[model samples]
Target: MPRTSEPWRKPPKAWKHEPGRPAPGRTHEQTDRRHPIGTRAHEGLRQASQGTRTLRTGPPHPMSTPFETLTALRDEWQALQPLSAENEARLWKKLRLWWNYHSNHIEGNTLTYGETELLLLHDRTTGNHSHREYLEMKAHDVGIEHARTLAADKSRLLTEGDIRDLNKIILKEPFWKAAETADGQPTRKEIIPGQYKTTPNNVRLPQGDIFFFASVEDTPPRMAELAAWMRRELDSPTLHPVAFAAKLHHDFVRIHPFDDGNGRVARLLVNYVLLRSGYLPLIVRTEDKANYLTALRLADAGEIGALVEYFQSLAAQSLEWGIKAARGESIEEPSDVEKEVQIFVRGQKSGDPGPPPRTPTQVRELILHGVEPFFRILDQKLATLSPLFAETGKPDIASVAQKIGLLLRSTAASPDYRWEKRFDFFGYTGKADAPFDFSTTIQVAFEPADYRICCDGNVLKSLRYDEMLTKEQSEHLAASILKAAFER
Candidate 1:
């Protein structure tokens, strides 16, 4: 690593470090090594993590070095924080699209940036691609949301389990990919989501050298070490978060714990670190991949500065975008225009046939086919049981009068959208004789596009109605609800 990765100035008058004394906020109160965020690749550095270091707190000249530039932009953005509040909604939307595109793009997800944006921003899918591919993109978006949620929890520290959960979320479900054994015979590997690779996952270099990551057996401990180091480092203010995030990313890549999606997870972990540290989640554009990989290889050969600078540059790009957005400047780039043109041109070429604009009729059809049967089954069961309760069950199994209404929400050309209906069965059967002596409200409901069964105020079964919920599904759901009632 180059010295520039940790630029410092003389200690400021307002702060001082005593050799035997702990740094003001630095605690020796051992953070749970598994504090939910670490792998143990570098535990040796934990002791030295508390060493005294100076941070550059002064202003920087315009167009200076990466460190100075980052500091200056960070301060500038910080000052604009109040006014930038409005910009965040738009910026976050753009970022979610950007982060999803580049992260998956680097891993050969075939969705164009435009398709990704539409799929995410509009909940509409276009493009001629494999259903699995589209699902992967959506799943990746979900994985990002998961990471963001985890980062938002101030009580969370990184953990091996969290990282595994992230891998599971991004991959969603596992399938098989063709592979070869050491003997070079063709074979297939099953990728179980959330599980580490059972076999060695290595890559062949252009020059025929096999570049290997931590072995399958070595993965768990190393991941634990890395998580440990990350949580410990997070408490130290010495390393710029960009560098910390970059190093963590590199270490994760080296571990390559999972059977697949390691790169994507590493990128996500980078954002997790950044976001949790109050920094912007960056987009490592797919176009810069060659330079990015080279930086990683260079870091592998002991020149970590290249990697640090590379990530610093990316962090700078995100910061620059923020600074521009905060200043109310047009943050549009040529690529943004190109992406729009691409989507428009694609549609114009032969008319992009998207899913027929969602109709209320479709929503209604779901209710009729998917939801109505379940409600009917529940109602019939309640009526059947009414005689057992007799005088005790006061209401005697009255079903709600099937009130269907259009809610105040609309989307995708469906003005009379948002279909919802509820069927509730309420009764009081006391003295432990009728229906286990309980007063309860069980509702089979369809809110907007979701079909759910509720007991009291809790949802017992929920599903989104894109396709008709089959009779089998409805019957099974009703049976499950009745079975639960009998048990209680």
Candidate 2:
């Protein structure tokens, strides 16, 4: 077992170290028995992580590091100190669920955010999801739970054992799975929980190239070096927490230590770093995966600024959410959380070809009865607009009105849309259809004076304009509103 010969530098000025007098500096060769020589198997990592410069001392000062900019963010999170334990617990739970969902989803875990929560919180399962997905979700929850435990215990420093334990949690009981070879041959690979890679692995590049990891033979020593680097950085106190986490993630992926679950373990450890520093965990949304990968690629090229900045931004955002939750404010749940909750509770399948179940019969009846007369009147008035709609081939405004009216009628009657109880005023109910989410809401609200046509409750137009629309104009307006709402 070789050890790192690199000398330890002075701790960062901002961070506190032991109060005793400085000990005599010793050569790394004296410590080589404990720390081993970490071989750089991936040529790119040697260039990217270790610059070409030959240094007489340790790496550059914390001030010169790319993570220095994260100081303000870290300070902001700390200044909101003394948060109630209840608040911390609530925020932590919310973040854990979110982080678990996104991280697992990125790795192709089939459980939706809702299903993940249902399994974790309610001990319930909703869909006919695969057994592997359920186990994956369960394993992630265990890993996060362990991270939280470690984060709360200030005395526990991160160790190689901890890293392996996280990997073990992620892999759980391993089984045979399909894997690709260096040249892209499909093969069955056996995974050993908590163990390093037994075979070579390569990542597929967007441009049809392969990015190979450190050789399997080098994984053990590289992991030793990583543990040493982590301890050194954590003790230094100058490296911004986010940057430290980012660096750790980058180096771990560069090593690609395990045959599987390396990415998942890397991300979990990133949050582990943040949590240990008294900061909230960042949930890297699956939607930002492309940008996230871009940041990593940039870091792999020896340009770490992008990855650091990305981590800082995500950390700041997560801290804001934590603070809000701690203060008893209603933090917005992830869009997936609400959507998934609805799916399980309401039994509405995702991507269902059929319309969602209809709203209550009373609500449907109200919409149908109230919309019928106006539609009839509009149908009669559309005769004057024949010339304007000639190209439509429907011939006249009545035909256009009829077609559009039918859709609106059907949409309002569907169970998939919801009725805003607040807008119900005897005749019309404010109804909405959030196809996937609140990003796009097709709405119909009954106003005091006239009906409002809207998307997500933002009124686009009023059905009654000056109370004097020409017959043809009325027909066109009605048809246009219906088209916009249904098209969305």
Candidate 3:
């Protein structure tokens, strides 16, 4: 066939950049027939496709937000600086357990704490959780790990893509879920992982009012706005991490960007803000579901402080535990102690032997791991009395593990295995008024079956191998020591 003159140089008829033209491949008739939208509507679609519109970003934080109180806790947690390797492992491990348990729990997950522990920690699964719920919990845990990794990378800036990716990660694969339509008809909605919603969604309030999130057409621009705001604020952080986290979570939730997993991704984003800023994640425990929802409801009604304060309390509590972990104290919540014990008992009954107990072979490793954190916890307790004294010193720790030669003792393992751990805090309290120097020592000696806890050559109590020194005991011990130091 004969080609047209300079055929390569001439653009296609469709590619002509003429005003009032149809799209590249479409004829005017076809374009007009397919897109009956008017000029204004077409422009709206174009803007929606671009999603470049920035939202009106709000203040970084509520004006009434208090900083001095939160910062003191934050600073102390930070000052601890580079926690011991063992404590760091323990702290993160415990946090991981709680984070997984509670995040799912507030969403009406039926898995008990023990069940969640086994699934996440031991590579085992139990309980009557539906296959979907089980998979979701696992996927959410993976999302948390991914978020931690992402937050640790100081170089990457926040982006809408990351949030969508998180929604995909936690939601795992796309599937249909039961949802109500805009007209309140029950139906299954197709969820495309990592994709924005194609339909509008809303909630029915307790008082029968219809509450709404961002419209389907508005999600993209609003999400883009949130991501942009996050990036800019990270560069110049004016708000406290807690406040920032609250805002990030609330904003993401308001947009409801993804069809499914928006709530999970929102919480993930909150922790992302916290982790990047050297703070612990604020866990909304299952028990606090009512309060959490109430706070968010109030926030939706223009009372931002309610949500901010709710988060501030959680952040403050989180900081206290972080400091505790940094100082070698147990970060286990009160419920954690009971949960740990119950799980242990369940394991024993089932002969599973959960989380390897201190064995004879691993005695040194156990002692090294156990004593350092114990000393750190005890040191903080003693450190408080320093202001009343003239000078103070860092606590000293020592441990020796060997069978003690007892004159009369009978046991199945013939004295089995034993270890001694000691912590010493020494200082002078009275420079002129008292002019006295004192050394206070606490020791825990572990045998095969039980452990003896002592202070200054006196046995305080002997607890079974499973028991931990409770906070009550520690507080009483501190008070008694302070009293004796002054009286003596």
Candidate 4:
């Protein structure tokens, strides 16, 4: 090798600049692809790529377009496809059972989740209910299977045939059933499966007027048009799947195409659209029936924004539940402890006005006191399950677990923790630091204005203005959060 006298050229030092300056890399123009050039920008990019940023970006805000909001939810759900596949069969069975119970219950099927699960999973039924309810539950499962089978083939479109089939499955070869007429006379009505109404069916309005749907002759064509619209929207890249599903649901109900089973089939088709489009099926909780109907009525009157928003919100909830389940995290919905505590506190305040309203400071102190017992109880529970955390062999984790238990319990108990606010108090506010991760904060509060309970920065529940929380509600919410922490 000829020894050229050229000095050894060193690899240019990684152009390190002074602190707080941009790193030596691409030019500003090049880095402007998205974020600005700096440590902060890099940190954001890192968090975004790893999805940590999304932890705070929950269901799309109401101000955003429904399509956009639902698309974000769908993206999150689609991202979990890998984890969902791990135990797809088992997860799906659970989801299907839940969907059946809620959907049917919303339409007056009258079966509990536990009962539905028992029947579907073990072919056994429990509790005291009409045999008709049991039959309806079984029939709903059939409808679910029909929808899922149809959904598996993406090329298939929502059709009059599909809707009729779903309705047939729901009604299960219907026969005459006892019913009531608008005249307050009890009677028996012919029940037909897979057919449009031959007689007039109407809903009573708040002002004592009957609202009729598409007439018997109009039902078939209206249904055909609805199916056509769904197909067109399904092909639209700009149309979010949840919106597509919701519109299908709304329009179907307005048509009242079937003599009966309109609501059940409408719900089934909604799930069909969702499942076909690679999203998790959702349940409009029976607990939320009033709101659900109100949303539908609004949608029927050319005001679909609220209904669309509602469905998108449900999709987001479904995404969260699926992700948690897939990740082996707790997927339980927190109970409404805020209402329970509010009722008790309100009763106390009304009966005895001796103690003045609580200051924020006093409110905070009482919440701590209420949770102290919870922490002690949780500690004993965790002790029995020590191996779960002890296996990590991180004393810090065990300690953090205890701290998290307190935070979870405190936040849950906050609503019921003796309130002493200044105004004719509507609700309470709570805050706690997550164990080990002091940077991570947890907050919960009741927003009386919206009748919503927000926990850990997410809206966990929506209650009626006068709703009261119960012990079962408070304990259920506390247990879910505590189990997640202890397992974590």
Residue-pair clashes per candidate, as listed?
17, 7, 1, 5
lDDT of 1 by residue, 45-122 (tens): 122222332121223322123555776777777777865566876677778888998888778776667678778876
Candidate 3: stretches off by over 4 Å: 1-65, 351-488
Q: What is the C-alpha lDDT of each candidate?
A: 0.64, 0.59, 0.64, 0.55
Residue lDDT tens for model 3, 63-85: 22244576677778888989899
Q: TM-score of every model?
A: 0.59, 0.59, 0.59, 0.56
Q: For candidate 4, what's the RMSD? A: 20.7
Q: How close is candidate 1 to the true structure, as a TM-score?
A: 0.59
Error of 4 at 171 (Å): 1.2
From the highest lDDT down, the ranking of the candidates is 3, 1, 2, 4
lDDT of 2 at 314: 82
Ranking by TM-score: 1, 2, 3, 4
Worst 10 residues of 3 by lDDT: 48-57
